[model samples]
Target: MKLAVLIHGLLAITPAAAFAGYSLDVRLDRSDGFYKVGDETVCTATLMNDGKPAVGEKLRCTVKRERDILRRDEFLCEGKAVTVRASMDRPGWLFFGFEIIGPDGNPLQGEGIFKHRMKTTIVGEIGAMYDADKITALDSRPADFDAYWASCRCKLDQVPLDPKLTEIDVPRALRGKVKCYSIEVRCQGRTPVTGYLAVPVKARPQSLPACVDYLSMVWQDASRTVPAEMASKGVLALYVSWHGLPTGKTADEYKTIAQTWYEEGGKAGDTDRDTWFGHDMYLRVMRALDFIKSRPEWNRKELVVRGGSLGGIQSIAAAALDPDVTLAIVSVPSGCEYNGYKQGRDAAALYRGKEAVARIEADPRRAVTLAYHDGVNLAPRIKCDIYVCTGFSDELCTPSSVFAFYNALPATTKKFMSTNPRTGHYGTTKNTAGDKRLSDIFRSVTVYD
Candidate 1:
């Protein structure tokens, strides 16, 4: 057996990143479309080089099973066509992709997907198969896990939530009928929580539901931090930035500040719970929840939280820590099954990295401290509704690890878990079944009037 690896999911080679002299664009006849198991799945690609067929160019296709390449083939990029034919022996995920050496000698690649359905799910596990309901987390609940978080929550409660809101003049792209605000709230940490708050100018803010888009692993942009459509859906929406910086900065200013913060924060936090790089982000989220609950315009029973990847981790953590959260929508969530590597499987970047491996090896206390942030360790404590979209072949956040988190939920918890075929490290949208479930979850909560 041979091992193949790519530090995928953080980012992959896309056509947009192609060499400037010759750029590539890929399109499928259809994507995230339907298919039946055992049906001949003929995958094809149009390799356009600067809007023309990439004639005489060498193109390669690699099909994957999880992180492993199941097969590889090469052909000339002629007639604007390249094809890879494959079929799921049974209902499961399949991936088809293309790569070519750019004029600069760097590889540029693109991908397309089709989900094979069996009327029900097949191949429920990604790496190291197990019963979805039976998979257990390797980290047992720390004896003080409940007590520690309880103390933190109580400490947070004792802190006075001095909140401030100011109307912001955003670019037209982010401005309109909705009134947007720059919001600030003092949490348990030295830094205050910050984000953009949006409310429908025509609707009574109190009359609508409330939603928080926690944010993704990618550092957020100060401009357009909040989704403009959030207000149209009958909700007062707040988009929180983990950086806790004021919104509305020039692009260069934002980038410089973010780079500085990452350098300062990532290098300094490794000693304890208080110093961990993520402690402030999570604590501030809880404080932000407190602020949301305090608003008279917010429906007390309709607070919904949503995120993907790292944001998904925060959303789950927030729901577990706060019983006031009503619904959580998470996608390809990281921070799950951190110790799955113990079983010859891989873990998400958040949990299983060179730094983490070193910490565990250097001192046992580091691992103990990290368990406090593990999403799987927090899953059983969640009591609200959860809708998660996970890829059957997400190498970044392994499906098996996500199942471990899902399986441990309280038996009474209302939850839905859906998968996309070979949809590695991406989000679910309305076009996919998992995304439809999320839409329905929110739809049920929106008031018609």
Candidate 2:
């Protein structure tokens, strides 16, 4: 069966050398870059100078199953492409990594005009997946998952939601059409639920459908214009910052605060479910919903939460935890199948790598903590209509882990999954045709009245 609509795109390439026109280009035999179990695809790694092949250049190539190296070899680019055939026995990814090595038995360096040789290694990757739909979660859901979340909600309920709204100016064209504000809602966490809210200037009470949009993992403040853009389409929209930090800060200020949070407090008491980072994360999600529902202009129906990557995680959690969320749309989501390594594949990016995997394995409590945060475990609880998008070649949110979460959803839930065969974690593809189709899908769900 044709499992996905193939998104053809230019092969991934390494950045060009600062002084030299040297780079590595990697491509797959199948433009779509997908395979079934036991199927093989040819990976071509070519050393290029300017635009043509770098004749007589020596290349070192390695193949990997995610981060686990499978094979290593050397080839000479003698006016031709160096190729390797790779396959996966299970539902997972295969990566081809390439580098140029000098005849002196070291990685090649770029030569500059002033006789300065920069230590720049031309490296690129070609990634693909096999039988992705068959992937399943390796970690089991905690027995008290529901009870744990219930207690969290109880604490949140005790805190009154004292919402503060600062009306912000809109552009000349949008001044009469929409009104924007920076909003802060009190939450159980130390920080408030901060975001931008936009409403149609003439929207009638109880007439506008509401949407709660979650921002992706970033150190910068949330976009101030996104909610206004959405409101222009006649929807009541709120764009929330995942960190719940104060908005209108300088970029550097936001980055410094985010860094401090990451180092000192992000994972504090991680082994304890009550004090875990996710505890506050979910509190923000719940508070965002409460504030949106409180709006007089809200339709009292059709609440949608949508995002991608880190935002995807919040969107999924919001739908599962809040019965009022009517729909969820996500793409290339992280935090799914957090213990995926236990299945012999790489875990979600947050928990990937040898050190992180070993640490989780050493502590049973950590595993339990992650189980509560795992999207796969939460999937079965989502009763809303859901839509998903994933790239077969994604390294961050591996297709296997994504499928694990998708498979765990209740069979009766209205759900759809779209795949981009040659895309990566960022959804980069050369197929303009296919990319337009994907955009259309998102616009339909996110911009509705």
Candidate 3:
């Protein structure tokens, strides 16, 4: 997605020390303002400290629903000023306004209306078999796959790792046996990407396996913590971020540009710029691998990449394009069968351009472009072993898509594990059981005598 720049001039406020005051600003950075039934929309509001920057201990932004489209009945927001935190939920638009309540009992309000739309394809009550069959046909041909990825390759020379373009530093607060570092990898474009890297202090030479995780909507940052349990297992972990994250103050802060990247039609000659969604992320993952392989302490040959949701999607893509990736563990990944998935759905509702979807569907070329980034397409191309885990209740990523990718795996050593979780889009209570099984499987396949 193209990054959005907030054009509102800064509002500077000065207040007398004896008096207390507050101000609220409501502006839509970029809003088409219309949505279909099932689409997800993000609206951002910036609240400025207009009064004596209070000595308050707490601040909050509450989104209250005014209209109930898509039956979105909740409000979710995470993080404070200057940090981009997010409230994770299924796809839908927010219909409420935001209010900030200060510690001293002062309330500032910002109000706006937004809508969410559903893509056209999945709108009706069609059976799963029809949807599955349509997707299978669209995704089946290898030729279609080749055409989609034709332009996605970055010449080995184009991979951005110049010391001049990127910077690496270890935070003093993180300095210790913990072994953590902050990395800023500059994309050729205007936006600079940043992420965190951590490794176990105690790891055997060849056993220092590394795992690179691609974050979802959240940006990569120091505050982001990986489960200590994973690190304790002697695996080096890196979190690569997209959007304004790892840098932006709020997930909503990055929504403008994020939406642009997935805009309706192919802008100019760009058939599928969204392909870079995985390409750029995978590039950063590989760069993290480069950093780990450079360390005398790590085992360069034992590298694994895993993620759930968006990260899961990247894991599969990276494994497909980069032969060095030894193992991939993916869960509930999005962006599998675009055309098939978007059919019958309102274009705006699907977070895509109506004209764009129509154009892509009419022309086989667009499907060709999608093939390069499709995890299902890449799954069969991965040379290494794969462990796939999917939740039966996942809504964002249908169980059918996960099974499609799993069945496509060309690796003879691949394994499949399904969890019938009552929850949607998350691993089961047996996640630990699944992890142990994966670790054992990796040891069996990759460990040398």
Candidate 4:
């Protein structure tokens, strides 16, 4: 995207002596364009002062999607030149507008509307694209065995589990019948993770079945609230944080962590260390499970993992990675196949690499590395019962991705429920019905004394 500006002079005879002045003009290059979801695109805006040039000015570009502001980039104008580049990581309709402020800190009055037209191309495959291929690949890789457990044990040795419960204030909603506590666990790399623990106040402390709940894309902290309605039914709910639970700080700290994680290339070791977005987040979910198993207060026999959206993806992935988790429930999970879902020109916009699927097909490691973080791959690895929910109206995470994962599950006890098409991503209470069903399934499968 590019913007250009021009200036025209006007002379007036009746205004205090002969006065002449020029009005600023601006225009952007590639005013209207289409991009693939997740693709990054650059736009440059140029401003001219009185036909010469204006240097050392400040430039600001504001991007909006629907009514919500997406991102803003502010920069110091270089001698007669300034360019602002922005990338859209998620899929959605986006609108962009820019303004150049002179050194005096006033908007350079311009004569142009300064408009930008945005379009999107849906890219990549969901789960259904390579179902058979993935299944075949898993089959060739010797079935998961006791040896795998040994390898995992060795890996666990590197990361000692510290299971410590810190008494915390329970939500007013859960104060009476359910007591809430926060648990902190240490991961292999000294990564500290915190999760919420809710136990029925009336229930005995020993040998109680526990449910490990992974939070959505949002951060989880002490103040985080769980549906007390579920705890009332005799389940010990553990709300695990996906983005390393936040410490008790101001709201600004929480917002910063959420946005900072995906700034440049993603987090460490995975892709672009400078950029803090990618699949490494899934590993954090696995670590949360490790924490749960390390706990003596929670029964290891009836472990359950559940979440929605990104959290849903983690739940499915955790169940697949760890056999100790006996049950899994996921709703509207994201991150599926890379090549299959990303397709066409718009798809190319969403990705940082090449556009053609054939190019990716020949050497898919680059894309596969990214997909390693996807829940689709994790779903088939789960050996226990699984429950999945899909929303027909979900725009952020398409129903196709959800179905792809649901169909890919190797678990014989897997079940799926879909909400009415009228509902979208916003309203999720209806999906909780599936959770109740899952609770029932968990009870039926266990022979509790």
Best by TM-score: 2
RMSD of each: 8.6, 4.7, 14.8, 15.5
Which structure among the candidates has the greatest lDDT?
2
Output the lDDT of residue 48, model 2. 73
Give per-residue lDDT, candidate 3, residue 414.
Answer: 52
Q: Estimate each model's TM-score.
A: 0.72, 0.85, 0.56, 0.57
Q: lDDT of each prediction vs. the true structure?
A: 0.62, 0.75, 0.45, 0.50
| After superposition, candidate 3 runs with Cα above 4 Å error | 1-154, 163-175, 186-193, 201-207, 219-223, 227-233, 244-248, 252-279, 341-359, 362-364, 426-434, 438-449
Candidate 4, superposed: residue stretches over 4 Å from native: 1-153, 172-177, 219-223, 227-232, 258-269, 272-279, 342-365, 411-413, 427-429, 439-449
Error of 3 at 390 (Å): 2.2
Candidate 2 Cα misplacement greater than 4 A, ranges:
1-6, 9-25, 101-123, 263-265, 426-449
User: Which tens-of-lDDT digit does each residue in 1-449 have in candidate 2?
Assistant: 12334354665455444336666667887776668988998888777776567888788877878667899889978867788987888877777756677778887554521112222343555677776667677658988888888887788889888999999998787888899999999998668899999998888888777888888877777877878977887788999998889999987999888776764436666687767776687789889998999999888877878878888889889999999998787777888987778777776646777877787777789888878888998998999877777766566777777778888888878777776554556534232332344345335533224
Off by over 4 Å in 1: 1-98, 101-136, 170-177, 202-206, 222-228, 263-267, 351-356, 426-449
Clashing pairs in 2: 9-430
Where does candidate 4 have its weakest 10-residue lDDT segment? 119-128
* lDDT for residue 321 in candidate 1, whole number 0-100: 93
Candidate 4 lDDT by residue in tens digits, 1-449: 11111111221101211113221232223322334545554544443334434466566666544224568777675545445444444433343445665567654542321111110111000110111112211211223333443465466558766666766676575677776666777654324566676666666544566677776655435333662444555666677666564445455666666575544333334332112244445556677777656555565578888777767777777787777888777676655534333421111112323433444455545454445544555555777766666543344565445545555666464554543332235343145545675657446532122
Residue 390, candidate 1: C-alpha displacement in angstroms: 1.7
Candidate 4 has an lDDT of 0.50
